[model samples]
Target chain A: MKHSASVLALAMGLGWSGMAVAQEMKAEVIHWWTSGGESAAVKVFADQFQKAGGTWVDTAIAGGANARTAAINRTVGGTPPAMMQFNTGKQFDELVENGLLNDVEAVAAEQKWKDKIPPAILAATVRNGKMYAVPVNIHGQNWLFYNTDVLAKVGAQEPKSFDDLFPILDKVKAAGLIPLAFSGQKTWERNLFNAVMLGQGGAKLWLSVYGDKDPAAVKSAEFKNVAETYAKLRNYVDAGAPGRNWNDATALVIQGKAGFQIMGDWAKGEFIAAGKTAGKEYGCVVLSKAGGGYAMGGDVFAFPKTKDANTLKAQAVLEKVLLDPTTQIEFNNKKGSIPVRLDVDTSSMDVCAQKGAKMVADKNQQAPAQELLTPPAVTGAVEDVISSFWNTPGQSVETFQDKFAAALKSI
Target chain B: MLALRPRLASKLSAWLALSPATTILVVVYVGCTAWTVWISMTASRMLPSSTFVGLRQYDALFANERWQISVSNLVVFGVLFMIASLVLGFLLAVAIDQRVRAENVLRSVFLYPFSMSFIVTGLVWQWLLNPTYGIQAVGRGFGFETFRFDWIVRQETVIYCLVIAGVWHAAGLVMAIMLAGLRGIDEDIWKAARVDGLPPWRVYVSIVIPMMGASFATAAVLLATSVVRLYDLSVAMTNGGPGIASEVPAKFVMDHLFERQNIGLATAAATSMLITVAAVVAPWIYIQSRRRRAA
Candidate 1:
């Protein structure tokens, strides 16, 4: 009887080892992609991870700030998820500095990300000579989407410069249509200001103000021009624009009630959802000028530091699956963004995405978005100034410039 | 062996039972408040560090235009919200106390909004106040072509819109409290007023209101706390927009704390709020305790 019991114990041990070998690698991923298209895009990553013998647990929070807050709190509270999302910026710098995030340098080196990823995004994701996050997609934050029918009806040429834009806006207004579809929320207001700053003030001044933190650049004549131009747009927007959501504003353009909207590429998702095709039903312009800069921002996932071997393995699997070439195309296509790796084929994407990809391919025109350039605190402070100036019509451009300079200086 | 006394044993057990609550109050509340105070004096960003920057964050907070606007807006919102809610709620309670038919139904209808959250309240008010599709457009659709009620989108008058929504949400709760207070009052007081030939309005204004001090204090304290933590309403309604027109101090602190990653500035703002509330409440609390002792 003793001999048989020993044999049974050995058999049980063998069975347990076999089970461990085939155990599913489970990972909890936190992200802010809760919209229909965004969820569909995130599902691509989940499916690929599942196929690779990993479990993808999703904890989706709706707002970016809320999701990041939850992820950061979880990390600090020592109940961290396997993977978490952040914008492709310096948002996760504290996590990295505090040794709270796991470095994915192995995957980055294996994939030759240093060579493939765009320089601006590569610089943003890399810190202290190590890759702390994986760049997943590139979103152009300064696209001007206009309704083709409205423009054609008004006999307005596609605007090629700020000088050209005013005439077109005037014509659209004269035609009894809302010239600009605008959301008066703070973030969207900031986005509109950034578009004007980039398109009118040009890349040099944009970099000096946001990147180099040059106070003089903010107070410069060009920046004053940009401020005036942004304020001028107030006349074109309807009185009901304040407190409107970005999608609602986009809906106005889609319904042909408005002529133009300066928004991000994600606005394309709304237009597509409304059964419109890019370049046919609506036209997308990165900036008015041909060589204008495209403000690039996107999302990335960072692995939290974990002592569990299984969770570590899952993180590795997620990092690998997220950047796989096929997964990039599938994910970005649904996400209304271009692949972070410029080598991906653009044939399947819409014309707007194709245009963004082409613009990103030219390294000279790739300007980092404000989040990539400044810390969120500084960006928020400057946003307050810009929005206040934009809403208060009586505020002079000189006062706006001084306040803008002071805001940058506060950082 | 010596036997323990029954009273001593019970007292020891009571102390043991109360220890956990005392510990939590000290650690979670007092300890965290102290930590926040310490952090506010430093130039902490993203995460709290031990770097001392003196009163620099406070200085910056005082200089911020948005912060200034948020404070003034809070004052306007708080005073108006408190007065309006109390008056409306008292009136509601008085009306319902007249032995009305379907008393239960009337009470619940008056108290329904208190059951809903501030987020729901804000969203409902947002829709109702929207210019393009809400009341204004509805009025225009009904042939009132010149009807205009777009205050929610305007900067100067947005706080009043918030006040309207705030009063609407809170008056129900106040009504319930006032009604409970009125129900608890002695029947003898009403009989005495009638014997003295006092008019109903005079009795209410001069006697009932003055006698319901405890209920008024209760409702006022509840309303005051909500005023300090007026975040979700502003977030769901205006998002501190139409260009920072409807921003409140709590929203500013929250934005700086998490989204902007400026913990020092956020704590500075939070500490300032705490100090202001204490300054306002400390003397009143002292006077209340003294009055109770005298009584």
Candidate 2:
């Protein structure tokens, strides 16, 4: 057989995710959430679904790309699982178009999913006027996490804007700790670069380059300055960052070894797992004062078409359990995200998640995850350029500006 | 009916009986190879669509900082890993032939890696190689401050880490194969060498090594297959990071096929890989058949 092409190519050989399900309606889901916290969080859904008279089969694959491949292959191989997870974006657009996915419109209509989910989140799950996936949780794609002790050591307060961020980063560096605990993976590097562009370059520049592909905006002096500032972040990371995992980078901030990590809200889970209190041991903030925004992405489960009547029933049951408001809150609470339902109570969530929930609740501050704006291929190729510049000592900002503009154009 | 030699007809019938497997081999292997080559000629994205941009992907593949590095890395890894495993395997096989103690234990130690899937073992190697969390960290704890085993992070030497793990997984199986060949050898040769006072190393190197040709061929084919299919190790260990320094062709093809969704470029890469293998193996196989014919 022709082998698969995936970043999480069981070539990545990491995750296979079922600690909780392997019992009821016998639904085997392949997912990438194999980390300690992620596994525990998914347990909520497993338990709830089993209670509703179904069997759960956990095929716990660690990386997202790996899980998707296994699911896709099995679906094609005539033994499709009841549910498979995907990031709420355009990733599964082709699957829907190819008629490989079963629409959950029956469940969506009954739950009035349209009114509960934020518009952007709903748009990602629904394709061509039909709901193809069920949105379970909302992940705040961009949030700034800082070591309160490290910030205090450097006499820096929570930075409200990118301008405020730069000086504080320098002060954190002067305090003899890493100013930014960056893992330096291509995607993360590009994300940090984009964050700075949005926070400093502002939304217009962000959209002009990503949405409009305006070569003029890319060639501007402001774009040059954004590149320079992103380049500045290079010096803040430690030498051991080239292949460091994102969680380990967050650990540096948690242990007071670093001052900042402009990562997703998932960093809070690492902090909480380490027994650190948010806003006390560590503090949270989002940059960009033109308006505060959360780059929104979330997890969704899609049903691959199955011929077995039992599997079909299990699929429907999984959809109902995943979208139930109570199950949604419990799952997202442990997952370091928020319920997709804007109506869910936020009092029980951690301080950082509360901030994210508040951001989603306010219509003015919702920004889509970069996945919504671009496809996986373009993002990955551009990420390569970003990681290269961040790692190489002599890469010029001007050269990078040219390459970045060209990358967006070509992709 | 015209009378024919029964033996000749029986031989022909035997070949006829073998046609199904051969047909499958030709169509599945040969058919896919042609499709792969054709796709490479296109500029297909997520799916195979004919948007012929002749040699654009090839140009990109060549100019790609990652692809170039992948070639060099594979060359280095393949040469060293192949030679080392063969040498070490032969030695272990010869030693085991001398009524060695705990043969099974040592054999299992070496052979177990091959049996356990590389997906898991590659992960294990990655963990063991990580400087902070693995052996280096443990060594420093025991008062070895001068310890410096950090190949996993270095751009210059990380491929060798792959070589190290690969050899660990392969040498044992090679040993078993070689042992079988060595045992099949006539005891008369060893007895004659003893009478002549030829040293053991000399006897082994000059006569025994040369005689174990079939085993060497088998091992070579096995190792070559592994080399071509190399993916799990690089992905689990470094993921072609530190700026595309540790990239491999298989990993590149994989990124295109699934992650990047550039199926055309992936098939192009696959097609070229197949061609390279054919270039090397076809001639060898032809010459081998000719030799067998003469024998």
Candidate 3:
């Protein structure tokens, strides 16, 4: 009996050590992609991770702010997830600064992300000479999604620039269709303002106001033009615009009741859900006359600091799976975004995404979005100013400019 | 020493009985409040830090247009909502107290709105108030092409829309409280009033209202609490829009705390709200205690 007991102990010890060598790579990922298309997009990453011999644990909270809060709380409280999603911006800056995030420098270096990813995006992911997040996709935030049927009926050509936009809008309004499908919430209001700033004010003024934080740029005549143009477009929107969701506003365009909507590429998800094809039933353009650039905003996954060896292995594998060229195409295609890596083939994506990819490929036209440029506090303050300006018809452009400058100066 | 031992044992048992409540009050309530106040004075963002920034956050809060609008809007909403809810609820209770038939059914109907959450109430009101596909559209469909009821979409009138929904939601709760108060009135009071040939409204205004002070206080306190924490309603209804016109103090704090990542500002706003409530309630509490002592 004593000899058998000794043999059994030895067998158990060997089994435990053998299991450690082939430990399970289980990654618990927290994200906000709970919608139909968003979930499908996320499943691509899950499937690929599963194929890579890892388990994908999804904790999809419905709202971005809510999911980030849960993930941040868990991380700070020391029981962190293997990975978490953040918008590709300063959302996770403090996490990185406080060393709560593990730098993915190894996988990033292996993939040569610096040579492949756009400069603006690569800069957003890298901090303190190390990459702290793996950027997954690039969403063009300033796209003009218009109804082709409405434009043709109004005898209006698709506008290539802001100069032609007013005429088309006027024609559509005169034809008794809603000229602009607008969502009046503060976020969309700010997005519309950014679209105008990027298209009309050009990239130089865009960088000056947001990136350089130059007060003079906000007070310039060029900015005044952008402000006046944005306000004028407000006249084209119907009274029902306020408090409407972005997808509902997109529905107006889809039904041909409205002419166009200035929204992100994600709006295409709504159109696609309605069985509308891009460039046919609806049209899309990144409107610009000069210095036009795609306003790039997207998602990234950051690995929370964990001492568990299995978790570390999971993070490394998930990072590679997230940015693999094929994974990028599959994920972003369903996500209604372009691949973050510019070298990938975007042939399978629709025309709108293809256009966005081409625009992203040009290094000169790569404009990082407002979130990439400013902290959330500052962006929110500026957004409040923009919403007030948009909704208040009597406010002068000069007064709006001063408020905008003051908002930009806020912390 | 033996006689004192029995009293001492009872005293120890009393302390043991009260320990859990006292601990919860100290740790959860007082402890968190102290932490929040400390966090407010620091330059904290998404995460709390120990670097103190004095009253800089308070200064910023005072300067913020959104916060200023929030405070003023709260005052407006609080005053209107409280008065409207109390008057409407009192009238409803009085109506039902007139020996009306089907009283139970009517009571349930009146109290149904209270059972639904503010989120549901706000959504229902939003749909009913919207201009395009809501009431106005219905009116237009009836060939009233010029019909207009677009208060929810307008900035100036949006807070009033919130008041309307709030009063609708809370009046029912107030009605139930007032009805119980009315039922608690002595039978002899009504009999004496009838014998004295007093009209119902005069009796209600002069005698009954003055006597139901506890009920009025209870309803007002409930409504006041809701007014201070008026977040989900505004979020569900206008989302502080048509351009931050319907913003409230609680929504401002929540936005800064989470979405905007400005914990210092959020906590400062929260602390300011606490101070404001204390300032208002302190005098009331002092007067109440003095009145009770004199009686």
Candidate 4:
């Protein structure tokens, strides 16, 4: 009787294992969006995937460099995750070239992504006439956020150009408030310099400098003015600015202790977390005189190649779910970014996000951020030069221009 | 019969015990180092491939301003951290060896920092040194409104902050080693010095230090290796910043390898560091071996 009972249990276990193998579609995804807002944003995709009969396994790493390193190392070691996240730029070019990633042309064609996605983002995700990654949202990298009460207390109007912005900064300074709440890290310093380049030098100069890698453009008189304007704003920041995190800088503006913070649209997440509504508690403007030449960068998920049928099916499901119109809206709403699809209804988002979505809809106003234009190596080297110039007070503009040109030449 | 074959069996067991470590040393250590040297000569980026561009990466690395700054900062940090830790460790060891009560507690308290990782030490020091919410703020709150201690935010003096944290983390280990050496000294030597009318400080400076050569060498080599691999403390505390003011060689290599996606340049930097360490260490090792053979 004991032997017979054991045999029956073994038979049931074998049958359950067989059924599990045939039906389950599990995907393990590695990403670097682990913050409160970012985690909520990623859960939207996980829920949508689950509702579509797939199991989502989330592996969240905190920093972008760390996550990419782990993902690439795992891919090389032959135990790759089903999906991995990278910046929506040339970061994944090597993965695609090495045949480590699976192309999602089937989903792209089925969803009519070629028409729905913006051409710039589509160009970034596509290489060699194949779609190897899926872009989820667009983040504007050059938005100027201001506290409404502080600006009103100082009787300052929103600056329409860099020329008008400086006097406003001065008034805030004279009113015993920090004129510009700035984070003095290298990346944030580079972000501010890029904003100045676009706002003061225009898109033509930006394309010439970063796109063409033109030595003449770096040495041009107009570029000198851009550098000077960026350097001039260094006077407005407090001494405690060095090594401060971006969110902490945003906090100064939120607490009405500062007038302005030039950061990305992601700053809106901090404001929302602090219960401050956009356009009332604070305001945002993309600093460009040419309507809105918004500087754009974003996140993308690329599927790693796998021969297993179950994993491939799971990848297909994820590719479709990420670009679904409803998923796009829900994900970007939590992420504080505009949806990648131009046709999504963004009216329910904050006023800043709506403005970004409207700007992205117009092709003429879209300027690719520096990461999309140049590789990380070149961008990082130039960032070193810019940060050094900003911190070293006695460094001249000519010396900075020479160093900037030299940095570009090395690449 | 078993007792008669014991020597032969012991010889076989010795070889068996040593084989695994030897194989690992040859394959993992020597093999990876050789592979890195070969890759440094190529123009690899984002991934390693065999497309040779001999010496160009080295030329670029030498010409790069960041690399130059890192080399200079490493020198400043290495010298200061080594001397400061040695002096502090020796003093602590001597103080704790004076037949004090609660000896075990004192030893553990002195050695606690070494048990904690450098990341934790760096973070603790970073908070204590921060201008807004740290020592400076506390000082100002005490009615000293003009007090300032913001070296971590200044370009010129940022590297000293790293030196401070590095010495604090390492001095404990040195103290443990030195204390062991002190306990092993002959008790008759102290009696002899006391009968000869020699002062205790003089005996320590002139006699005891010269006899503790092995312990000093051990502590110096340990501190030297830490200085060469000093990446995490700088990363956690200042991140080579206030604008590349405290950049070190290991951090530069790592940033290029993973973050910048320029593996060729990263490997080239690593190779340069390897050559420098070998240049400094090879002669010392050779001289020590010769002295041992002569003795």
Which candidate leads in DockQ? 3
For each candidate in the order shown, give its overall lDDT on alpha carbons: 0.91, 0.81, 0.94, 0.91
For residues B104-130, what per-residue lDDT tens digits would candidate 2 score against the true structure? Answer: 888787777789776777788888887
Measured by lDDT, the strongest candidate is 3
Among incorrect, acceptable, medium and high, the docking class of model 3 is: high
Per-residue lDDT of A1-411 in model 2, one digit per residue for the tens?
A: 344566546634432233233333578888889988899999998899889987677888877887877887777665677889988887777778768889999988887889988987888888889999988888876688998888888777788987898898888878788888988576787778878877777666776777677878888987888788888777777756767789999989988888889888887888888899888999988788566467888888999986656677788888889978789888998898889999878798888888888888887677777776667766776777777777665878888877777666554
Please report, as a residue range, the 10-residue window in candidate 4 chain B with the lowest summed lDDT: B238-247
Best-to-worst ranking by lDDT: 3, 1, 4, 2
Error of 2 at A365 (Å): 3.3
lDDT of 3 by residue, A1-411 (tens): 998999989988975784485478888899999999999999999999999999888899999999999999999988788999999999999998899999999998888888999999988988898999999999999999999999889887889888899989988999999999999999999999999999997788899999999999999999999998898898899989999999999999999999999999999999999999998999999889777878999999999998878889889999999999999999998999999998898899999988888899987789999999999999999999999989899999999999999998888
How does residue A310 of candidate 4 score in lDDT? 87
- TM-score of each candidate's B chain against the true B chain: 0.95, 0.91, 0.96, 0.93
Off by over 4 Å in 1: A1-24, A307-313, B1-5, B184-192
lDDT score for residue B67 of model 1: 97
Please tell me which predicted candidate would have the highest TM-score against the true structure: 3
Docking class of 1: medium
Task: Write model 1 residue lDDT over B230-285, tens digit each, in one string.
Answer: 99999998899889999999999999998999899999999999999999999999
